[model samples]
Target: MSIAIDFNHVVKKYGDQAVIPGLSIKVKEGEFFTLLGPSGCGKTTLLRMVAGFNSIEGGEIKFDEKVMNDVKPSKRNIGMVFQNYAIFPHLSVKKNIAFGLENRKTPKAEIERRVDEILRIVQIEKFKDRLPENLSGGQQQRVALARAIVINPDVLLMDEPLSNLDAKLRIELRNAIRKIQKEVGITTVYVTHDQEEAMAVSDRIAVMKDGYIQHAGTPQNIYHRPANLFVSSFIGRSNILNATLFATNDKTEIVIHDKHRVVLTNIRQELIKSTKTNVQVCVRPEEFLFTSDTNGLKGKVQRSSFLGLNTNYFIELESGETVEVIQESDIDTLIPEGSVVYLKLNQAKVNVFNEDGSVNLTEGVKNDAAGEVQSEVNNVAI
Candidate 1:
């Protein structure tokens, strides 16, 4: 039975040092939740707290309203998959998956029934008799996954389970893990530093920094309408530009490079009411378009690279700051280096942040750290 997980101002301490001060988040039943951030950001520390491997100093960690702070690892009934495959080298794939059930003293016939079913679920039936040494990296990871889920634990905890595999194998196994998790319908808490992997696998992601959650929402919400400048830069590639904001009644206008202008009506009303100016703008690589008209930000192309579906250009703006621009690969010749180009901003998609890069002033952005998740995924303007 899958269960909901909730953290209520949870705190973790290692002796005198408090790694996680107070963190709160929610994971719906059967939802794939990912904790993503750079190293030492406390993502792993929080995951350990959930698995009962770390001591909780304050607040509560609950699985469906049942406090888990004092629960032992063995009594928690959770399955863990680590970065390194922790399978027994001497045991065959079949034995590795059935080891848990055997320890519980399950019937021999029931063990065979469950083991055979899990082998098929992980698609490693042919290698059931093979030892861990004989299997490939991807296959060994599959064995680890099969072992973790065979017990039908209430929750599955995976900490960078694919980090040890090659790039191709990582992609393959990530997709496989997502598929298997969905098929089994187990609530999972996945931890990783890989943003792309997190976005690819999670139903929702909690971006963490310094033991605090910066933002928590669906992949689209985080990518298209981030809560702050830190989240904007972390989840994907973004070009941060300094600009001035001016408000006239209901409409807001932003000027870049003292020349190019963008008018918006959907800015947060509070910002307009307060007449906040001198802000930072976050424009994605694909949000800038080349235009023949003079009413745009002027830049000189420095270099261009063709990456099959999209071509990337490195351009130096009039202010001498370099920015990356991505456009669809066209049949025409590539924009040569040294060519002056006028770039137009997609006004609807560009995000504006306060001078400190702490709050997003764009309309429809929640800007809440530990508050409720975005109820609407398509909060960005169309």
Candidate 2:
């Protein structure tokens, strides 16, 4: 019984400071939505409002068309999994999971059935009698998940549940969480500052900054077609280039700092408009094609590191700006620190920004570059 969650012009304030100002977004029923941003950016505050831990100063917070601003957290039937595994150290796994059901005065036999079902769902049935102290971090997390979900909550809220685990375990547990979430079909709202984690798990992500949602879309849309300079720089490693854009004979041409020229012929006709200032271009580390011959921008490799699957090269462009290039290492070769090389920008996929850190939708408007990565991943055949 998942319900859609909506924030209608929501605002949160502390005395004189506004934390979340005029924010409006919706999470579909049974959708895995994420609030992704850096620290002190009010993502957690917004999540708290949904969980009934904080008071909404203005506007409405709705669950399935019902206003929930004054609803008690306990009455909301929402389950929250906190950052720390928050399980009872003295209680066994079975007792901890059954605690919630017991509070509701559920029938003894029904409690056993539900508890047993959740344990198996979380794959922790074998450790039913084990205490939280006796279990591994991953296992304790599983117990925490089991406890939160055993009551059949309608909306599942997880706040940085995997932040304390090691990198290897983080990946493993995140995948497990996604799988388990899908199995339950609970409306989920996950919060994390980790960009890769958000992209990996979210069906859609909202990039927040300074109490404002800068961009909101699918993971592919946020990464490949960022709405502004902050999003481009924050979501991933992007080479931001200052360029001038002008049109001649209905042809859009962007000159990099008015030096290197690249013709953009694929910009959407409706998005093209007149601009008054220089444009900022965003290109990912993997978007640059490297070659020995000077086919595009010529630069010298300032440093290179072999990352097993991909080789990371820090190249200093002739324009005196440093750009990072990530190339897949199919070949067993290396480019020394001071080698000269040529790199070409995949312009069709490039994102252009206005002077005010907003995207220059007037150029390269759609998410075409996202398709390029799909082919790259498909080539791996796994």
List TM-scores for all candidates, in order: 0.95, 0.92
Model 2 poorest ten-residue lDDT run: 373-382
lDDT per residue (tens digit) for residues 1-382 in model 1: 9999999988888888878888888899999999999999999999999999998999899999899999999989999999998999999999999999998898999999999999999999999999999999999999999999999899999999999999999999999999999999999999999999999999999999888888888898889889888899999999999998887775688888787789977677654444547889999999999999888888999999999999999999989999999999998779999999989988889998877777777876643346322222224221
lDDT score, candidate 2: 0.83
lDDT by residue (tens digit), candidate 2, 1-382? 9999988878899998999877887889999999999999899999999999999999899999899999999999988899998999899999999999999999999999999999999999999998888899999999999899989998999999999999999999999999999999999999999999999999888888887777777888788777667878889889888888775565777788456677777544454446434677788999988866554788899998898999999999998999999988767688889988888778778876665555545342232222222233223210
lDDT of each model, Cα atoms only?
Answer: 0.89, 0.83
Clashes of each: 0, 0
Give the Cα error of residue 41 in candidate 1, in Å.
0.7
Top candidate (lDDT): 1
Q: Which runs in model 1 stand beyond 4 Å of their true positions? A: 366-382
